[model samples]
Target chain A: MRLPRVEDIEKRIPRPEDFTARSRGPATTARVGTALGIAFGICFLTGLWSHFQYSSPGWLPIGPNPAWLYRVTQGTHVATGIASVPLLLVKLWSVYPRFFLRPPKARRDQLLDVLERASIGVLVAAAIFQLTSGLLNIVQWYPWEFSFRRTHEAVAWVAIGALLVHIAVKLPVIREGLGASVEDETPVHSDGPSRRAVLRGVTVASGLALVLTVGQTVPFLRKVSVFGVRDGGGPQDLPVNRTARAAGATRAASDPAFVLQLKAGGRSMSLTRDELAKLPQRTHRLPIACVEGWSRNAVWTGVAVQDLIALVGAPSGSTVIVRSMQTRGAFRTSELPGDFVDDPRTLLALELNGEPLSLDHGYPCRIIAPNRPGVLQTKWVRELEVRT
Target chain B: MRLVRGLLLLTGLGFGLWGVWLMRDFTSEQLVSMGTFLAGGVLLHDAVIAPVTVLLGVVAARLLPGRTRSVAAIAFLVWATLTVAFVNVLSGQGGKPDNDTVLHRPYGLSWVVMTALIAAIAATVAYRRRRIAGPPRSR
Candidate 1:
């Protein structure tokens, strides 16, 4: 007996033509593709905004006034990603026929088919990577060794590029399918629901996916957001990513001998937590907009970073590097740009809401800046090196 | 239109290839693992998930006649999509150790309740469709 080749096995399996559902056609594919494309666009833009928080490229300037800008962008990123899951599935299923499509007879047409198939494969792979990696990241699961943030950003460009190429290739088909009525599309013989039914099903599924997990950012919906990763419950009603125990900062942060080291130029000054608190205190109600997309606004009272740096003779245009007492982690120290240092609202926060900072909330002191990701908040501050 | 299409294709290819090129410095292991995941997702969906969905639709259609067929389809769409989206959460990984608030709900129970809720809604949809069409009439 001859060995079965991959193609032979594939031929035995159900091809796209085997799917006789009325929903699996050009009309349904076009409609779902339209929705999925929009979702992908929104997700891509917002994801870029969130990624900028980490790299801070000079060309794209993000302001501090809208303390909720990162909140909105990151929130939209995760939510749109969640919503896109169903639409993506539906879109792929509707186009499953393309996988089984044979090459054309002419050499040029065959070449074009091969190129289209290759690009489609790349697009599908990149899209799935972006969504799945994002979902896994939010829950802090790293099954792979590669850096999620770096890999995610790199793949995002690939995905968007492939999407644009796909649009270019299918523009005529898309226009034709979209322009004509769904009822008028070329259909395979089937005993299934109308195109409208499939569309409605996809919409409802996508919408459910959104509302079910968006409560992490939209506070009011927390109760109904059954699958929301972060419930917005922690110290001072703020969610915690790295706690005192988790960071191994409990003992070091609680030490009475602890003094925040403030350095400017070649000089350094030290102040105890109480002394830092006794200095001119300012309160800024800023949101701890975490990278994981959970955010909550809290009233934080502490010494302004500028004021503390001023005592050490660091001027208005100075940049400060906030260092944490946390024994372990990637963001042990974060550099605040001149703009952030000059911002009057930036504080080395000592209190949260109306109460003292909980151990999990970076007790003693934490950096709170408007429109900043939580990781850079620099909890359990041990040093502030101001450079003019 | 030709110019537009060409520009789109070139820009897309240029940018995409550049991105892939930039990551050339990643360790061979990292690259391999990344490729595995990227390719794995497409493979799993195309080979297993899509076929399973098609099979489910066939089964649902055969088991239920008339309008209830649509009900089964919609219900499966909602439940399967949501479940897959929250697969990590349902897998007990969402509730991390030492953190009480992250994915705090009993997800297994949540999944059960969610399934029942979907079934209930599906039953209602089936009932309404039955009333609207007043049962299947022979051709």
Candidate 2:
């Protein structure tokens, strides 16, 4: 008897399992990547604008509120870049299986399939390098010999270009995907979470990372946040004693003590130059490697970054990035590798060669590292980012 | 391929451990001396290689006409490859670099060149399609 065949029975089943497998496709990753790419665009444009402002001063279009605009924009640029990390990671994971597919069902489909796969690969690689390198720069780590500062600037251009192509190529599919109502093609899956559910998870995770990262950098909540305070204390990277003495021995002689303000953990706490001198001091010799092709080792006397972070009630994390203040006018920041941040010996120095810091020598404060570039050891630091 | 992947993983692990070992062996004072050489590598790559590659790709893209798309794709491959190579060189990672250089070097640069090339190519393609659609002009 032609009692309803398996096909007929399957039609009536209305299974959720069908949707699960089908949902894992190029479009999913493309959508996720597209969102991240747009975010990347915002960060790139903001960073570039900030770079111009720093380099040329007044070249950037100044909005109505000129005073706080640079700070806000640069802050946003960094925040968004850190935030994009998880989004990029999830997007890549989503599209990884697509790389193994056979020829597409149609010729046009095949062309698109290849383009989608290629773009995803490039995007993932670029995103990883940029994010990792940028993260390292903040921590004052330069494990790789290639100029992180130059490489960062260069790769940024490349990432932007790839992102544009990725957008252009996927525009049609994106339109189609957006056009389809969620209810219309909802398929059911047996073994795994639905695509919608996975996407929601990704969004939540990325959001959490962003919130934590942003929270660490902002001045209002920084003092109490777990990331820890920067205290602008570190080994002076340059020869401040010689410089100050060379400028005028009399001025050096008159100054009984070098004064440096200790501000760390997003202005959670502050210690004036006089205050820092009153505290029992600690000195350590350290190396300063700069991506700009120079290195200096000097005795640094000041407080440890971790100690300051602890004092301000900031949480010391597994990773932290230090922004150097040496190139104040240029958007020049170096990364301290994650391992060094974990080290107990790292310091933010107040003095070099038994004298207080000089202006050219990252006066008031500079990072002194067991192994870190001078660029990563920021001078006049105003903020620090710590990630657990 | 799995064996190769395994080998690569082992090599990477070895290098990382080696770096940690070196750090542990050297006193903080000696690290400064090591940093001097390390910083030179960072500077050379950042200042010279990165900017040169970008400039080279831009010039190449301009010269190649319709071939710009392919060249742009090739350029990114070149850039990423060079980066990895230079990084390894500075880190003093042993063994010759893999031929996957073709794939790795160009990833970043390809996107830039390809985007410009594709835009120009698409515009040219569209314009040609439009011209052909109209009646031929009299000679």
Each model's TM-score, in the order given?
0.96, 0.42
lDDT of 2: 0.49
Across A218-334, the per-residue lDDT of candidate 2 in tens digits comes to 545432322211212233323121122222223422344643323334545555566666666778765443322223346778866676656655554434555533322343344
Candidate 1, superposed: residue stretches over 4 Å from native: A1-15, A184-188
Most lDDT-accurate candidate: 1
Q: Write the per-residue lDDT of candidate 1 for residues A300-367, one digit (tens) a residue.
A: 99988889988988896588888899988899989888888788889999999989899888988999
Tell me the deviation in Å of residue A10 in model 1. 7.0
Q: What C-alpha lDDT, on a 0 to 100 scale, does residue B79 get in candidate 2?
A: 29
**Could you tell me how far off, in angstroms, the CA of residue A43 lies in candidate 2 after the best superposition?**
1.3
Residue-level lDDT of model 1, residues B1-139, one tens digit each, is 8888899899899869877986878998889989999999999999899879877877877788856776787778778988888886787764458877677777788889999999998898789878988858855
**Stretches of candidate 2 above 4 Å error?**
A1-23, A26-31, A57-65, A104-118, A182-187, A223-388, B1-139
Highest TM-score: which candidate? 1
lDDT of each: 0.85, 0.49
